[model samples]
Target: MVQVHIARSGVQLGKYPEADIPVLIGAGTVRRTDHYWKKGMAYWLVIGRTYDPPAAAPPLPAASAKPVPKPMRPLRYECLRCGHKANTVREEKPGNFLMEICTWLANPFVGGLYTITREAGKKALCVNCGSEHMTEEVW
Candidate 1:
């Protein structure tokens, strides 16, 4: 029995028994252009020129892939500071007069723009303690 060493570019892939060569090749892990070396070989040679097999066969079928399930996203906010079930609030702020006036003076088209804000998108104001902070977890 002879041992064969496989390499790609200049990096050695591994040393394996001669029997595994065809399987590795058929499995698509080893390519034809990859270099091969054995005990009697003087130098590394390409697998395509050196390795003689009956005929090229189709690659072994890989195991069927199963879809990975995604993690469930949190639906509600629970206040950490006061331990209260928090509510989600969408807050819109009216345009600031100062900014509006400045923008109006600068350009009327841009002056009418108001700041679109989600002030409490993920944050909750505790009804018990009145502390405004991010919720600890989903309600």
Candidate 2:
């Protein structure tokens, strides 16, 4: 199922009304490209010109311009030192922004796969080591 991320609400709308949503000239979503669709996603919804209310209705409430929460992919990586947990790389789910931090550095992750992080300074060492010399920064 395609996840419909509400950009204004920061909510992940995993459930769609159906397999495909009708996009018009005014609505906020529109199909932008066909490249990924060929990759075998269940569905997709791209944002387009936002639809507004008609003149007959009352003024719409002011909604906070919060960013929507995109779908997150599972990730696993071990620390090179002491064999501990390290940073997680979560891929962007179908029909969402790949730029989201949660979706960054992700590679088509699957279960039962493990790769320890490259060896670095003591700062990158695992918590079990309790190293005194530490430099803070994942990069």
Candidate 3:
């Protein structure tokens, strides 16, 4: 392979393989005004005039092909308190313990249903140690 020396504004950018010249042009690493020369050449010339690179290969046709769907991801989070990874505890509203116990005792079934249905929103609980503060782990 022929080795070509490249220069920009009379400053040398070092020598590179002739085949890489096209790649450098495609990647915008070299400008059309950049100068090129080889051992046999007496002087540098504008790369655009010195080299005639082959045209890029055409992209394949998409004919009747269905796009692949991305896979579903599972929910994962870390407990801020215990640093647990598996399960998360649900956060509950703060209230008087005595009052809450009395209310639960009055109607255990209804209280339990309400407790189950309560929303935690963005907050998560650590299931390992029942911690309320949870940090979500981005996949």
Candidate 4:
């Protein structure tokens, strides 16, 4: 059976697999969440238990496909002075990168009941120039 079963108190996680006869009933503690349960040879009455990882299928061909292609370069720009590279950031159709990220960051809270707060991803920055704009990741 699955180790992580929801319980009444905090949660009643199982220590042994469903295949074995359960004697001890303990809370679903993080340490007991193993894939398999082992029996103890040393302790007869108080024997042992363990967890085993679930079986997974072998990797399929498509699961190993190449990464999506990117452009030779993007709108990412950088500077030569600070070397703090970053991606161009903006919100709405803001005037600059700062405006973009700011908009994205606040959009969630500002959207109110109907709107959602999406993650405003950070663009790559030019470490050499301290610019908060990234071109693409060079091969």
Residue 139 displacement in candidate 2 (angstroms): 99
RMSD of 4: 24.4
Off by over 4 Å in 4: 1-118
Cα lDDT of model 1 by residue, 1-139, tens digit? 7889999989999888898788788778888999999998899999994555558678989877777878666547655675666455332245455775677789866664432222223334566666665464653
TM-score of 1: 0.37
lDDT per residue, candidate 2, 13-98, as tens digits? Answer: 33333234343222534332211121244643344322222336677887887888874533234444445443532222322233
lDDT of 4 by residue, 4-97 (tens): 2222334444444443333232433333322332343332122224322334677776766788888655434444445433454332321455
Cα lDDT listed for each candidate: 0.69, 0.35, 0.73, 0.40
Off by over 4 Å in 1: 56-139
Q: Lowest-lDDT window of 10 residues in candidate 4?
A: 43-52
Candidate with the greatest TM-score versus the true structure: 3
lDDT per residue (tens digit) for residues 25-77 in model 3: 77878777999989899988999845556766797787877878777565577
Q: Model 2, 130: alpha-carbon shift in Å?
A: 99
Query: Any runs in candidate 3 off by more than 4 Å, and if so which?
Result: 58-139
Report residue 32 deviation for candidate 4 (angstroms): 83
